[model samples]
Target: MSSSWYRDDTAPPPPLAGEGWGEGVSTSDNPQEERTLSRIASDDAMRPPPQAGEVKTARGQMSRVLRAPLLLALALAATPAHAFIAYVSNEKSNTVSVIDTDSWTVTKTIKVGQRPRGIEFTRDGKFVMVAVGDDDTIQVIDVKTQAVMDSLPSGPDPELFAQDAAGKTLYVANENDNTVTVIDLEKRARLGDIQVGVEPEGMTISPDGKTLINTSETTNMAHFIDTTSRQIVANVLVDARPRFAEFKHDSSELWVSSEIGGTVSVIDPRKHEVIGKVTFEIPGLRKEAIQPVGIGMTRDDKTAFVALGPANRIAVVDVATRKVTKYLLVGQRVWHMAFTPDEKYLLTTNGVSNDVSVIDVAAQKVIKTIQVGELPWGITIAP
Candidate 1:
C-alpha cells in the first residue's frame, strides 16, 4: 500500500519553479509550498505579535487618520460666519456711519467724499460703495480694512446707484445732469450715459438685470432703461417727488414713494404701469401729514414699512392685501429706513430729529433712538 509521508524543515524554501500545476508536481511543489506555508507555521515566528495595548492604540490611530480629512472638511464648510454691518450715508456730515447690528452701535465713522447719500455694499461683500452726490463719483471702501479704496467714474452729481447681481456693473443716477451713468465696476470706468427726465433720485435694476428703473423727482416718472443697449425703453408716470424706490423682495412689483404727493405708487415692472397706490389718511392728521419717503419690505414680501416724514411715523402695510395695517409713531421727519437681516428691527433716519429711530418690527413700536450725523438720508446694510 502506498502512503503519503510529511517532513518539516526549519530553513527557508526555494522559489516557485513552474507556471503550470502538473508539470513539476513532486519536487517543485514541496519547496514552493513550504515557503507559502511557513508564513503561518509558528505563532512566535509569523510576525512580532503586537502587544495587546499597542494593537488597540494602532487601530484608534488608523481610525483617526482615516477620518481626519472628513472632519477638516466639515470644519471648513462651517467657516465664514460673519456679522452684518449697516452703513448710513450722512448727507450733511459728509461721512459714513458704520453700525454693528449685533451690538446696535456705531463701530466706525468713515469719512467719505462730499455729500454721501446713497450707500451699498458689493454683492460679494468685499467693498462698500457710497454715492457722493456733491463729489460726482462713487467712493468705494474695502470691507475687510474699512478704508477708502477707489472711486468709480459717475456723471455730474451722482445721487444714487444700483449694482447688478454679479457686481460687475453699476447704474448711477445723476441728479443734476438728468441721466443714468452706466459704469463697469471691474474696469472702474463709465460705459455710457442714458438721458432721462429731471432730477433722477432712486435707481433700481430689474431682477433679470435686463432693465433699469430711474425715478425722476420733478418729472414724477420712472424711466425704464434697457441694460444691454443702455437706452430708455419706456417711462411710467408716478406720484410727484419720488424720493425712494424699492423693488419687492420677490421682484414681482416696484414701490416708489412720493414725498410731496403723500402716497406710495406700486407699479408692475414688466408693464411699466401703476398697478396700485397706497395713500394714508390719519384721523387727526392731515392728508399731507403722511408723506411716504423711505420704503422697506420683508424678504418674504409679506410686510412693507413706509416712513411718513412729517407724520413722525411708519405705516406698516401688508403686501398681500396692499393695506395699511398699523401706523407706528417714530421720530420727527423720518426720511429713510433699513431693515435688519432677521427682519426684527427697522431703523428709520429722522432728518429733523437728527437721530435714527429703531422700531421693533414685531411690536410695531420705536424702541430706541440712536444719535447720528446730521441729516442721514440713504442707508444700507452689508450682506
Candidate 2:
C-alpha cells in the first residue's frame, strides 16, 4: 500500500506518516484528519482581527470624501444665475444702451438728455444716472422700466460723477463750470458745488469715501477734495490734458491719465506728489494716436489698464513696477471700460466704431463686439 502526507482538522499532522513506502508509517493518523487540519490552518491565517479605532478612522475619511462633492454642489447652487448689466452712453445719438452681460446682447435703448457723456449706476443698483453735457443735467433712469425716472440738479455741462460706497452722495463734474456739484442721492438734490480746475472731466472717490479726486482736462491737474468739508485739499499738477483719475484699491496711490501728454502719472494720495510716470512706445504707432483717456486698476492693485483713445487699444501696466507691459487691440476709438462684478469681463465703449467691445480679462482678448448707437462713449456696470 502507498502512503501520503496529510493534515488534520485542528492542525497539520505532525509529519508525513510514511517513509520508504511502509517502514516508518504512522498508523494512528488518517487522510481525512490531515485534510481537516490543513483547512483549519488556512482559515486562521486568512481571518483578520477586528480593530475598533481603525474602523472609525476609515469611516470618517470616507464621510469627508463624500462631503466634498455635496459642498461643491451647494456652492454652485448659491451662485447668481444672471450676469450683471452694463450701461453705455451714446454721445451722438443722445441715447443709452442697456447690455445683458450673460448674452452680451443689448436689451433696450433708452433716450436721455442731449450729449450724454458719463454714465454710472447707483451703488444700490436701483437706478442708472447719466451726465448729459448738452442738457446740463444728470438724467436718472429706472433700471427695471428702462425709462427716465427723474433728473438731478447738476451744474453746467455735467460731464462725469462719482458715488460714495454708502451710495448716499454723488460728486458731479461740470466741465464748463470747472466745479464739482455735490448731490445727495437720497434727496435727489444738489447739495453744493466745489470749485476745481479748468474742465473737470473724470471724477472718483476714495475707498474710504472721505476724499474725492477730480481730473481737470485743460488745467492738467488732479484736484483732491475733502468730502466732509467740501473743500479742495490738494492740487497735484500732472501732464497736459489730464482726463481720467482712478484711485488704487487701498487708496494709497492715485493714477491720472493725460490724453495729450500720452502718459500716466502715479501720485501719492497722502503726499500729493507724483511718485512715478508710465509711458508707452510701440514702433509704427503714431505718438498722437496714443492719447490715454480712461484708466482702470485691478482690485488687488497689481495691474492697471489704460485706454488709448486714438490708438484704439488698451495698455496693460504693471502697478508695482509702473511699467507698460503690453498693448491690446480693441475697437475704434476705445474710450472707457467697466469691469463686470466678477471681474471676468471688461466692456469698452468704442466711440468711432459705434460699438462696444467685450474683452475677456483672463484671455486678454476681445471675445465679442456688440453694435451700439453712434459715438458710444461713457460706460458703467450696474451694481
Best by lDDT: 2
- Tens-place lDDT per residue, model 2, 187-260, is 77779999999999989988888899999998889998998999998999999999899999898899999999
For candidate 1, list the clashing residue pairs, or say none: none
Among these predicted structures, which one has the highest TM-score? 2
Counted clashes in each candidate structure: 0, 8
lDDT score, residue 283, model 2?
76
lDDT of each: 0.81, 0.85
Model 2: residues with Cα > 4 Å off, grouped in runs = 1-81
Global Cα lDDT for candidate 2: 0.85
The root-mean-square deviation over C-alpha atoms between each candidate and the true structure, in angstroms, is 19.7, 23.6
